[model samples]
Target: MYYSRKRQPDDLPQEVTAIWSCTNEECNGWMRDNFAFSAQPRCVQCNSLMEKGERKLSILENTSPNHSKKK
Candidate 1:
């Protein structure tokens, strides 16, 4: 007999948007999504520290098999 393990899910993907903004309260500036995953992000308008915003799951598409038990 052989044994096997199931694979685990990976980290959730970051939010993808066409536009963004700086996180610095003092320097509220608008930014773009081109620099989302980069180590450093600066607000082009105010050159302030920027952080990715919370992800919003607007679209839902199930890729897993329907495993619901029949009644």
Candidate 2:
């Protein structure tokens, strides 16, 4: 008889925080979330392109390091 090991599911990456803002400067809307490694998110208020603002290195917290670096 041959024995085989079971395969386990891949672990999720560390929660990276980001702030998404609306492309329309007039709206100037924004939001924040613990973005997963495999998910695409958009602005909740204006439904505009969500740009990656900044990254948070702590748990249970949301920080925007590049709030002024919008593209």
TM-score: which candidate is best?
2
Give the per-residue lDDT digits (tens) of candidate 1, residues 5-54.
Answer: 75333434444544466877877676444434444667776778776654
TM-score of 1: 0.34
Instruction: Score residue 45 of candidate 1 by CA lDDT.
Output: 69
What is the model-wide C-alpha lDDT for candidate 2? Answer: 0.53
Off by over 4 Å in 2: 1-17, 35-38, 55-71
Error of 1 at 11 (Å): 35
RMSD of each: 14.6, 11.5
Which residue window of length 10 is worst by lDDT in model 2?
62-71
Please give the CA lDDT of all the candidate structures. Answer: 0.54, 0.53
Cα lDDT tens digits, model 2, 1-71, are: 99767543333344466656567776776555443222456566676666657554344442555333323
Per-residue lDDT, model 1, residue 60, is: 32
